[model samples]
Target chain A: MLEAIILTVITAATPLLLAATGELVVEKSGVLNLGVEGMMVMGAVAGFAVTVSTGSPLLGIVGGAVAGVLTSLIFAFVTLTLVANQVASGLALTLFGLGLSGLMGESFVGQPGIKLQSLDIPGLTTLPFVGKILFGQDILVYLSFAAVFGVAWFLNRTRAGLILRAVGDNHASAHALGYSVIGVRYVAVMFGGAMAGLGGAYLSVAYTPLWVENMTAGRGWIALALVVFASWMPWRAAIGAYLFGAVTVLQFHAQALGIGFPSQFLAMLPYLATVIVLVAISGNRRATLFNTPSSLGKSFVPDR
Target chain B: MMRLELVKRAEKSRLMSVLSPVFAVALTVVFAGIVFAAQGHNPLSGIWYFFLEPVTSLWGVEQLITKATPLIIIALGLSVCYLSNNWNIGAEGQLTIGAIVGSIPPILFPDFVNPLVLPLMLLMAMAGGALFALIPAKLKTSFGTNEILTSLMLVYCSNLFLDWMVRGPWRSPQGYNFPITIDFHEWAVLNAVDVGGIYLNLSAPIALVLVVILAVVMRSTLKGFEIRVLGQSPRAGSFAGFSNRRMTAFAFALSGALAGLAGMMVVMSEIGKLQPVISPGYGFTAIIVAFLGRLNPVGILIAGLVIASSYLGGEAIQTSLQMSSKLATVIQGVLLFFVLAADTLILYKVRLVTGREGEGARA
Candidate 1:
């Protein structure tokens, strides 16, 4: 039972992990894209629709990423190109994506979704609970772990990573140093969108195996909080996602076990947990105590 | 190019002001046409049915108001918060709480059909929403927590609480195990006014009156000036001896009260019984209405009407064209994109980049 719960946590956290890491990258570039939810929903709809039509889970993942990127382009154009307020533009992106995805996925509801086939490694599959927990998962689940490590390494070790970090930290300063802050941000935003989309597709293709209206169900918001809970660190974000996932899964398990608490109240437990974590981590300083991109949520407009 | 331009241009004329939202609609139609074509539909007919059918029918117009009433009220309150530079993203939660709290009056006092009961319900809704909002306000003022996150996170709590109430304590004994409350009595219902050929609810007038009152308060009052001052520069506000704590609390409370009013109106007019899904994303949609209205109460009223049309039209298109009603949502979202982009032109100028000149401009 404990092992099953552990497996559920890992499976549940994977999508959030994918999204939060991407948002971390976007925030690092001094842009706050609130459209993460919208992008994810678009991915969910697009991935589900395409996967249903094509019968390929891998194509669905790609479709989801592409859909997210396309939806994010609206945000990029508004905030980056037009110099609209990042927060407001992001809100618009979300509204647009939510509406668009709902429209597109209306017919796709109640249909069976193509699930990503789990990898079956001979040696790895032969091992104990650890092997089953780690190696015997679907492609996206493993990729989510790879993404966290990849983002961490990229943010810390590489020169390109430094440029992206600098763009996020202080766009004006980065521009003064001859780097294209807007260009870097545009790229980062698109990447963030792709990751967010992939996360949503994970829900439709791997986790739920069906499309539902607003199926992301504020997981995007949870991913947003995870960025803060992790204190904007890549590795911490992964852990935070799992932590949230564990809490969410526990709520379900509790209800299934017929625990004393009202199931409705219990259903709200994960969101409440997010608030508590947010309050605990966020302080008056308006800066993360850990390594946060200093210029997160600010727009970078290049002049001509 | 090296010189400073008038960073502040005069506000658009009244004609242009009205035209802007219309223009946004036109832009939406154009983009929506493209979207429909992408989805393999005739663009012109699709766009026409989207707007014209909803307006032509009496029933369609009624649905529009039914859909729009909560949006306008909620957006009216949100304008004040946005203007005060306080982003209260949890109006959805406030609305949910408002419905939960307000329902108590009708549910508990089922035998009492006094007019005052309705008023009390409204008052409780305002208080509930205000009280819920105060959590984030107090947190922001004391712990310096982000009100955006706190308020937004609270929405989930409120939703769950509402769900619990409907499924548990608040569930009607005679409801036959359904996840809802007993139907509200006729006295509890918000009476619809018969206006010439069409009928409209009292909520419309209430929303319009509140919009005017808010506009007057925002434009003509000292408190309004203080809110504007505080939003633009907290330091400047403090330097002028204005209280940040007081203003922050006021902004949040006021916003919460409006959201609560929206809740009362919703329960009174549309959904007579409390359910888990009482609000069909009205709280969140109101944020869009608020911004699209440029955070002006009057602007939000107009924006509310326009957005409300999309909801009505979305349903119309779904049934008529066999297109998914979700397309209406997509259209509204697309409309928001155009409106935001158009708003940017009003606030800032976009310049093209050409090689090293862009680099020099940055420096």
Candidate 2:
């Protein structure tokens, strides 16, 4: 029972973790892409469609990442190149992604997806309670952990990460220092998009192993809120993702346990928790300023 | 070796401000053609069918009006929020709660028929939406939480709440296990100006009145001036004796109230009963409407109609050309994307310069 619950939590948390980790870097670089949901759905469709057609989940995951990058490029071009409002452009990206994916997934609507199978370690699978939880999980689950560690390490220790944070903290200052603000932002946004895509791919290929319209179903938005909920820290974000994943899976458990509360209300736990967490943490000015990017959702243009 | 750069203008270009959305519309039509052609349809005809034919017919025009009514009403309120720099993207949730709250009158008082039923429903709906709006507003004002994220997250909560209400408690005895409430009687339904299978309801005129009132408010009133100033510079507004915290709550409440009324209109004027899904994402779509109208109430009236017509256009092509109904959504997204991108042209001009030549000249 314990292992099973942990499995559900990890599976549920992986997508949120993957998406939020990418967005953390994007936010660290000081660009708020509200369209993570859109890019993610686009990735979901692209990954699913590719997997369905090519009969390879590996290629499908690749397809999902590439699709996310392409979708983010639109956001990058509008917000970075044309210097449009990030909030509005990001909203547009979400709206477009949902619609385009629906249109593209027309043929694949009812088809079954190729599930991304779990890893096979020779001795790990035969071990007792700890085996599956630690080592017998899918590649994506391990990737989620790698992403958290990699991002936390990159943000605090690396020079490139420092430059990314510097650019996010103050674009004008970063420009004065001769770092390519646009270039760094472009790369960051694209990376954010790719991660978001992988998150979506996992949703279709591994989580449900099916093609459904709006499959991401506001997970992207939850992931966005999770970033704020975590104060944009990678480790905290992973924990938040797991907590949220537990909340999401709780709906099914409530139905099974015959909890008196309506299942729909139970299903609303994650979103409500996000709002509550955001409201709760918002009072900490020090945390807000220290961890939150100052230039988030603000448009930056080089004056020189 | 020509390089392109965007130069900021001293003043926003008057002509570009007007032409910006037009350019966006034009760009959307062209890209829409590419999308349709990619889907194995004739590009030009698809454009005409998708963009033009919807507005060309009387039925189409009426359908456009029906869809635009709630959108205009909602966008009018969002215009207020946008002008005041308060982001309340959870209009969908407000709409849902409004529908649920508005249904209370006719749902409970099925046999209590009175002349005041519809008006009471409208009042309750607007109030419920405002109350829901206040959640995020209060959070922002009191705790300094981000309204955009909070309000949007609340939308999901409201949606689930509505789903639960309709499915668990409010589910009609005769609903046969379906997650829908009982249908509203005549007292609850908004009387329509029905002609040729088209509905011209009181919602349109009510929306029109709001447009006029808000347009004037934005143009002349001191409160309106405060909202504009607050949006442009919070520091300046603070110096001018305006409190942003109060304004934040006020803007959200005002917008939320309008969103509530819009939600009531959807139920009273169209659906006539509460269900699991009350809105077709009108709250989010209204954001696009607010922006396309440039956040002007009067402009929202026109912009809402165009977007509503595009919705009809999606349906039009779906039936006529067998295209997917999602086309309208795609076009709306494309339209918003371009509209935002075009907004840059108002404050900046694109110029081409030779990069190496400039370096050589400097040398």
Which digits, one per residue and each the tens of the lDDT, describe model 1 over residues A1-304? 7878888999889889999999999988888898899999999898898899999989999999999999888898877776667777787787778777876787787888878889877799758788878888888988898999999999899999999988888788898888978789989999999999999999999998899988998888889888877777999998899998899898888989998889878888888888778777766355564466778777554443
Tens digits of lDDT, candidate 2, A170-202: 999998988888889999999999999999999
TM-score of candidate 2 versus the correct structure, residues matched by position? 0.97
DockQ metric for all predictions: 0.55, 0.72
| Residues forming the 10-long window of minimal summed lDDT in candidate 1 chain A | A282-291
Q: Write the per-residue lDDT of candidate 1 for residues B1-363, one digit (tens) a residue.
A: 332211333563555445556677788889878876876888878887777778888877778877788899998878778877888989998888877787787798799888887788888999989988998999888776778778988998888888888888889899899888888887787877888766888888888888889899889999889989998899999998999988889888888888888987888887788988878889989988987787888788878988898887787778778887777777777777777766655645444556566446445
Model 1 segments more than 4 A misplaced:
A284-290, B1-22, B39-41, B351-363
lDDT of 2 by residue, B220-328 (tens): 9999999999999999999999999889888887778888888888887777788878788899999999999999887789899989988888887989899888888
What are the Cα lDDT values of the candidates?
0.83, 0.89
Q: What TM value does chain B of candidate 2 have?
A: 0.95
Query: Listing candidates in order, what is each one's chain A TM-score?
Result: 0.96, 0.97
Superposed Cα RMSD, model 1: 3.0
The C-alpha TM-scores of every prediction are: 0.94, 0.97
